[model samples]
Target: MSRTAVYNLPARWLHWAIFGLIALEFAIAWTMPDIHRDTRPVGLVAWHLGLGTFILSLMLLRLLWRGVSGVPDPHPGPAWQDRIARLTHALLYAGFIALPLLGWANASARGWTVHWAGWVPLPALAAHGAAWARPLGDVHQIVAYALLGLIALHVLAAAHHHFIVRDGVLRRMWSSSR
Candidate 1:
């Protein structure tokens, strides 16, 4: 891959950082005790909440960075394929941004305090016992599963480019250095 095709250093960094955090969040979510009306934000639940907030903050930073710096020119490809790639990227961003807010709102409804790393307090998205926010936890879970599907599609597409299409698409955002 040519150096010019690569994303800027911070974009590359944030991409991987967010990916790692998302993986960790999923693992914690899978293993943590099931959330209920009486559940307290402790242990894995606290970690999950803090990490979700952190991921949301990083994603917002990433969006700001993308806006100011913009992405490198896309790898040349068939128009339809390019469109699909763009859509996939957009959906990924949407999912990452939305998932946390849903979780946060649900947390708020449950009267759970969402602190950043167990110290700094983050604002609640909904009032305690808010009916509107009650369903968001389920929505969050459903979207999480859908986002996993999108992630799988993304990896498969990258693999196709790397192994079959023999394109440099994967390397564009793979790392800071080629």
Candidate 2:
């Protein structure tokens, strides 16, 4: 296995930060029913909606970073393997960007307020969409599940390469140092 520079510290921080928040958000949002929309306590929903806003912002900035700095080279792999890994990462990015917007859209369409980290209020995207909210909400949920699936495959593949296959892919991502 060859060495490649790990992600930049900022990218790494954002990656792991969003990763933890997303995992927590999914666990809470999926396991529990939608907080009666109106009856749910502010503290709890604040975290959910707040983290979702954070994810949205981080993903946006990450995309801009990628557009400018581009993807860091992975530890060397076969052409097909590299392509698959790249494609998978692209899918994850797309999911990261889309899921939050869908949730926001659904919320917006329903005229709900989104809080940023429990403090800031986000502008609504739509006036109201009584009928559309359910479907978009469904889309948001479905995509969240899809993101989990892709994320699992990604983590498993990273682990497999690092442990079983004795590859340096994990090292390149695990830390930014030599």
Candidate 3:
């Protein structure tokens, strides 16, 4: 079968849905009270943890879907540009996976339980008061900042393709056309 020129409907939905979830994750994290071992998680902190688990699950599903369905053909561009694009996409996927795992590890190290929608409880990777908690939290923060930068770059590149380059690269993922 011939490869399509644009992403399939499921792919598009997954892309946008994940995007929204990531935004919500950031919003929750920023607005929520600081969660420490002594403090009980209530409002936004609980939402953050639950939403984070959901995002991780969605990321896994997105990766699986991409692997099974494959992606549209690369847009016509210089080899260097294409390589950069591929690298950017790789980093974004890595960030999606790494950020959540890092948060989970941090929570585990701090003796915090992460629940899925406050119903299903996830096991902690480390014991409470683990020495690694602080360091892991630091790493998580660093990675989160870097991921935000990468996202900005990705958005600017897509806008450049759509507006300046007019190459239809952005349209492939944005529109529902084959």
Q: Identify the candidate with maximal TM-score.
A: 1
Name the candidate, 2 or 3, with the larger lDDT value.
3
lDDT of 3 at 151: 92
Q: On residues 1-178, what C-alpha lDDT tens digit does candidate 2 reach at each position?
A: 4433677666777788878888888876765546455544256555777878888888888778767665566667688888888899899998888888888877777667887765788888666656656578788878888888999999999889878998677666568675
Count of residue pairs whose backbone atoms collide, per candidate: 0, 0, 0
Candidate 1 lDDT score at position 118: 58
List RMSD in Å for every model shown: 2.3, 3.0, 1.4
Q: Is candidate 1 or candidate 3 better by TM-score?
A: 1
In order of appearance, the predictions have TM-scores of 0.95, 0.86, 0.94
> lDDT: which candidate is best?
1
Q: Which stretches of candidate 2 lie over 4 Å from their true place?
A: 1-4, 31-41
Task: Write model 1 residue lDDT over 21-62, tens digit each, in one string.
Answer: 999999999999998889999999999999998998899999
Ranking of models by lDDT:
1, 3, 2
What is the model-wide C-alpha lDDT for candidate 3? Answer: 0.84
